[model samples]
Target: MNMHSIPGRSDAEGYLFTRRAAWFAYAMTIALMLMDYIDRQVIVSLFPYMKKEWNLSDAQLGSLVSIVSLTVALGALPVALFADRVSRVRSIAAMAAVWSAATLSCMFTRSYGALLAARGMVGLGEAGYGSVGAALIASHFPNRLRGALLAGFFACASVGSVLGVLLGGVIAAKWGWQAAFGVVGIPGLVLAIAYLLVRDYKTVRLTPVLERATESSTNAARHIIKALTRPRTMLWVCIGGAAQLVVVSAVWAWMPSFLNRMHGVAPDQAAKQAALIVLCGALGSVVWGAVADRAGRRRPAGKLYAMALMSVASLGILAYAFGPGAALGGSTQFLIIAAGSFIMTCTVGPVSAIVIDVVHPAVRATGAAVLALFQNLFGLALGPVLAGALSDTFGLQAALTWTPAFALVAAGAFVLAARTYAADMGRAAEAPTETNHLPLGAARA
Candidate 1:
């Protein structure tokens, strides 16, 4: 049987593919996700080298990191919209190829301007992969497993970040910073080709409620707007998620530099130490995501509350770790920062699931893209640049200390989201889409 032609099984189980194919798709998507972050974050560990070679300012170095997220944010909606209307697998493969190629180009750029533009291209390539991949995973697997699986999927980001920081520093120490980009860029190209083999659900047709008899330009705009704004839950979640990521992105981007400057650690050793904290974050995303999933089983709104509590905890932990704790000792501060790292990523998985849960199935990717927009633009893009500017003014430690307070804003948004989550979910159920009631394909693996 042709794998692509196998009809999805339609039964209570509601799985779109056989267990093996679904898991295979899941694994491939996550692997690409790992490569995504590895390429995006490896630059962090190379900042020291870049600064020395180019005599770059902190703001300029931070811009190198922020530009990717900025492009990702700007392009996410359109790319996701295209994926929703076209083929997820093809779109993802194309995106991976673009980003991987962009990463490769970075090694050849001798000037700062060329490298910055290349980094922006990488962001454009990565723009919609996360939301599109999440949509693919949600379609392939049963709903019961969505939370844990998505958590694990996103956790790979932190894992990749750890490796990126670790490898970039070590590779740069031995070879050169430019070589670090070349080394990390290869695996993604191979993965992009392999991803063409992954299964994808057929595109969900837009319902009459969304696309009336006349699918005109006006209606299309209306459709897209409604898809993004129908459930207020998404708005709050987007804000909350972006707020939280401000903390994550800032620390991840600058921790190695912070350790090097504050503790007298060498650049390579600082990256190795910082990678440990990112590893803790990866573990935390999975653990807290499962916890949120279990809590939701009892009370659908419990997930939001759990996220809120975590945001608060992260606020307190991180603020102290970068603030007063710095005066204690390098060893003491590292321990506190690692603990904060674990708690701060609690919402990464649940936030995606939350956005997915409340949106119409047909526009799932687009809806999730909205969340990505806020996260990449306001949170990830803002964090590094803002911190860098502060570093340029006050100092790196002061910048890090102040950035964690954004988690407080995140906490409030989550609490507000809980107020309307149950109702928004009910509204989403009324949305007629292929994935909710019909299978897209069967497994041929």
Candidate 2:
């Protein structure tokens, strides 16, 4: 059934559900997001054990983490482009199965290369989750409440990150690193089944008149390339949000290791601590999204300004985290780091909301895919590797010192991003009538 065909007020009927089915769909999407986070972070929590077991060098270990992100960057655009032509729900379910199985496969690997290969496969699966899921959620929710809903969905990352670290750490400590992989990896099969049970909401299609006039063929490659090359959009994709991912990746991937090496926390303890920080960060994301939505209602740049301020705060916190302060040695350090982590996470919901807001709905998936590609390639792929290499060459503390610099650069990007909000909103407002075609099939139907 075409869900959008239901008769009612557009805003009420489209979203802000009164029906149980609508909420169920929304919850299912969030669950998918949560599982996606678990798959990505399970390896992170097991890093300490893996390091000890494999006798891996810092650079080599960094490469292991980087491989997944590299694969993600490579896969994101293609999967995103493909999603436009196929069913997003089906694509996500397939990806979930692939990655979940890959995660379990990590248990069989005795060599670093084998493990890296497994992680890369996981990355391949995860590549579809972000772009496709974001697009799906945007389509499901009305534009008025999009920011709040996406924030709720994105907050699952924090939940998944924390749970992955906590659960993986405990499992690894009790059983083995392989057991950790098995536990986190096996759940995807169940989630995949659950995903199949959930209904797929039909997207609102773009007008056909515009589609025929604008393009001779619905070539996915052409669409992806065009979306990626949009000047203002590309600028934000590469420099703004993706740059922040770099610093975030470096910290989230290695912070547990850092605590163990420098502060002398055991593997499990460090993981738990990291999990706590992630939880706080998750809360911050939800709160920030709500506030930004409210503020954006009054001013167009509200979300951008919130992101900018958070970026600056995150920079200061990271600098403190790496500095030679007495505070780093105590339990208080966890609280401080948690606060910083929360602030960093606060940017996620708003950044996502703004990016989606700026682009036309038809190319939303493509825009998100390009953004994910930059975020993975530059931010996730390089961030941890660069930090780990620096730590190896210098010291852990010194490596962390570089985080603030990246954070500052991210903050600057947000400042630039702030300027484009009005223009983006304007473009989006005019897109339906002016562009004449739905970029995605949903708009045309």
Candidate 3:
């Protein structure tokens, strides 16, 4: 049952066209990503309980989220490069198993230190999964569908985040917070093992005659360094994505507490309402991604332009949602924040698509890993910690009010990404640097 062996699903360029196995991998990868975030985020729901029991400070609470992102940032490049050099399928499965097992271990923690250790393990497991998974999905679909497909893939974060908060709240309330970790952790383990059965594409190889025409001095380290850095577009895209994700990560990490502390909402109700806001983000990821796909039809840079526009729009909505408008009724505030949530996530797909667009397929996983490294380090790793510190000083409301300003920085980076995007794409296509040999470990045994 080698699904990749089946014919009629790919073009001459080796990009997969319409195919059953392609869609199946899409489903499985996206599902695994969903479970990944669920396990990663479910800890947020237990923050209140943990704080009560542990008597932790806001910094310690924020550290729980930051440490995971920090570890993921540290590990992303190495793990992604290893996956590119090894078997992506196996790598992905191993990552899933590690994270799931670590998450399950969270249930046994007797002190804050134990939970911190376990969370770092979860980060190690989750680090390279995104880039490897994105690379696999990109290789299986044509460029035309790249934006929508990747965006849809990333949209699972919203779903996973929402569900994690919702489920964690409900289960923790009825049973206990430990039960919340168990419920989210077990399904990921199942999905990890099941992923081994999925078929993978073989790397395209050169015939003997064609091998002579290819360059002999191809260096992987050189290629990765040159590709990820020189292209002004790639650098800006990575920085911009990190800048924008700060807002998204902070909101996800702290909104439940915002609801509880500011509005007097119960834990279940707070998580439930926060989930609704995040659900809007899920909707935005898919909708904006599809829109970017359609808009990118004739223009190579259309997707990046769309990202910049949407990001600016999001900044305005969020600024309003958290500011003077705070005095509005709950219903109006919810709608405003929901709108911001949708707009805030518009960059997920287009940004990912842009990264793959500017790099050769051979280096795509590493390219993605590099971009994710910045995103996690600057955005996910820092956002919550910054928010928590601000909350400690200025109050949570003011801390959130200022988070939207970072979106301007994100939008500016997107504009910079657009300026050199088309040029970068053209240069990468014309360069023969990556054609010397197929990527290491890309062949099936």
Q: What is the TM-score of each predicted model, taking all chains together?
A: 0.83, 0.82, 0.81
RMSD of each: 5.0, 4.7, 5.4
Winner by lDDT: 1
Candidate 2, residue 359: how far the Cα is off, in Å: 3.2
**Native-to-model Cα distance after best TM-score fit, residue 175 in candidate 1, in Å:** 0.1
**Cα lDDT, all candidates:** 0.82, 0.69, 0.77
| lDDT per residue (tens digit) for residues 171-253 in model 1 | 99999899999999998999999999998776656555533511443444355575667788999998999999999999989
Better of 2 and 3 by TM-score: 2
The candidate with the higher lDDT, 1 or 2, is 1
Q: How accurate is candidate 1 locally (lDDT)?
A: 0.82
Question: What does candidate 2's lDDT look like per residue over 294-328, in tens digits?
Answer: 77787777667767777788878877866744355
- State how far residue 211 of model 3 sits from its true place (Å): 16
- Kindly report the root-mean-square deviation of model 3 from the true structure over all alpha carbons: 5.4
Best-first order by TM-score: 1, 2, 3
Which regions of candidate 3 fall more than 4 Å away from where they truly are? 1-30, 84-90, 133-154, 193-222, 290-306, 360-362, 433-445
